[model samples]
Target: MGDVVRAPWDAYFATGFDTCSEVLRGRNWLAPDFAWQERQADTERWEAVATQEMTKTLSRLNAPEHTCQRRSLGNLFDRSTVQRLTPQVEEHVTRLLDELADKLRWGEADFVSTVSEQLPISTIGSWLGIPPEDYPHILEITHNQVHAQELLPTKEQLAVSAEATVQLRAYFTEMVRRRRERPGNDVLTGWIHTWDAREPDRERADEILYRLTMFVTIASLETTATLLSAMVELLLREPGQWKWLAEHPGHIDSAVDEVLRYDPPIHINTRIAAEDTVLAGVPIAKDSMVHVLYGAANHDPRRNENPDTFDIRRTGTHLTFGGGVHYCLGAALARMEARTLLTQLLKRFPTLRTVSPAVYAPRLVFRRVTSLGVAV
Candidate 1:
């Protein structure tokens, strides 16, 4: 355990294994505090509708509301549900791999765009009841939302993303309405049924729909894409690991976990202290902005020996998925996606190698390579 380190912008960063773990499990809000909000507002960076709705999202909510939302929607992503959907996942994986094979035959292919990005969107889009035609629109919005959060985005980029957020809310709002009128055989319909049956008022019904839908669309696609891309980059960089995987298919799960630990898709999880608390012997003041560096925490030496090494056989839990009540609801879904894709990738393209230099995205909270050129 270590003392919390103060950062430049009135922010506190909790590092090490125990410190960050405690902060995540403690009373905290995923959303920034009033001070941070004021700073964003002062700079005209705050999108009111997006900010407010995101606060109610599954990851941001606390207490009975979070519990209720989690329980109501939990079945949609339960073990049995994911198992039932395995064939669908396999279908997407096979199609994407086939496409990649074609691209690879033509010399080189951008793995991130061709495979890492499309699979999650197609799989999650189908689950969300999004029409195939609407995926382009939704993917555009997700890209805008993700890019707008860069370490140093331009003013114009912020404006564009704000508009995208508004559009995303509206899109979901209408989607929820349609689902209500003629419920479908998809996850959104299940969510609509759960929310409407519990909260009948039309306005609250709409609110529930918009928030959850937005959260799911962004969270599922972006983080999983990042994970997939990073996994490919890491494995390809260490060709030995690739050969090892091809030889020992049983280690695929460990490889996924190792990739998660080595370069977690989500690097930093922002939390605001709800009340005065002590984390790992560090006194945290109320309303303090605490950055639980999951990336750092996962790599903490205390938590894992030789933390810097990318060893699939390494043993220990990692905080790639946060701890306690807010642990990722999509953990299983993400794991399945990575496992299916990586297993198929190793089996199909055992000799796949990078054809171009890796280029990383300019973002701190998330880790993603902009493009990964590869060939067999």
Candidate 2:
């Protein structure tokens, strides 16, 4: 067993499969309380404005609110919704891949920008009825905001992030107004229907819709973008496996799940101890910060027979989307997006291979490759 890695703020890292699972699934630890109003309150900076506001999102909400939001919006992400989105996803994947065909033949092309980054933003943004023209600006704003959210960000960094957050809030506020006036078949419209059902004046509905929209639009892009690069990188590491997948297209489903398990986009999920409890015999004081290392637990030998090996046929589930109440809300869409793009990519260019070493973005909470060059 490894020793506990503690941060300056007294946060504890739980890397063991059993320990992490227990902490994540049990009621001992809870999501962020969102009670803090300022960023730099104590000696060590425990939060940033970006993170502080993010705490108010569905992922970080406590009990009743979390349950209400999840239930009301759960059907929108069900398998059927994903199936319905398949054709649109395919069109985008095809268009993006076609754009890269000429560039890849030169034996090198930055797939991260050309494919990985574009696919998610385009697909998710289009699905939500975000205007085609606004996507680039939105991605840029979110990128800046996400990077500025360092544990100990500089004064300048915080200032920039605060501005970006303001821009995002305004963009979503206007978008929500438009969607409410002219409803359609997209997710925003569906959410509008749910809220419009009970709320008469639309005050509560507008607040809820705006928050959910801002959070989902930004968070959704991060995962799918990273997962696209990570999955391709992992498969090409074992060319034989990539070839195997190309031959047996039916394995795409398992392939996507395995990628999520092997190299999850989000590495750590935090939970505050609700009450004093013992996790794997270690005492965790009430209100202590617990970091559940999903990436580590995913590869724990005890949990999987050969955790290091990236086998598409690996059975059971991983903590990639997490577990219990906080499981990733967009899990279905992420899987579908990855599976769709990879399946089509391999079929179109069976000889596609990574040409350069992957370069990861500098971030603590996310595992995103900033650049990955590939050749066909």
Best by lDDT: 2
**TM-score against truth, every candidate:** 0.92, 0.92
State the C-alpha lDDT per candidate.
0.80, 0.81
Tell me the RMSD of model 2 versus the true structure: 2.4
The per-prediction tally of clashing pairs is: 0, 0
Q: Lowest-lDDT window of 10 residues in candidate 2?
A: 35-44
Task: Give candidate 2 misplaced runs (Cα > 4 Å).
Answer: 2-8, 36-47, 148-157
Which pairs of residues collide in candidate 2? none
lDDT of 2 by residue, 39-105 (tens): 2247234455665666677878878888888777766578788888899999999999988897876
Estimate the overall C-alpha local distance difference test score of candidate 2: 0.81
- For model 1, residues 1-376, the per-residue Cα lDDT tens digits are 3547887876788888788888777655444533446554254444444444455678666677778877877655788888987899999999999999998888999998898889888988888878878877887787777655553457776667778888888898888888888977877877777787899796987787778887878888878988998888888887588998889999889989998999888888778877777766677777677888887888888889889998888776799989888888788999999999998999999899998866777778766677889998
Q: After superposition, how far is residue 35 of candidate 2 from its true place, in Å?
A: 3.5
Single out the weakest 10-residue window by summed lDDT for candidate 1: 41-50
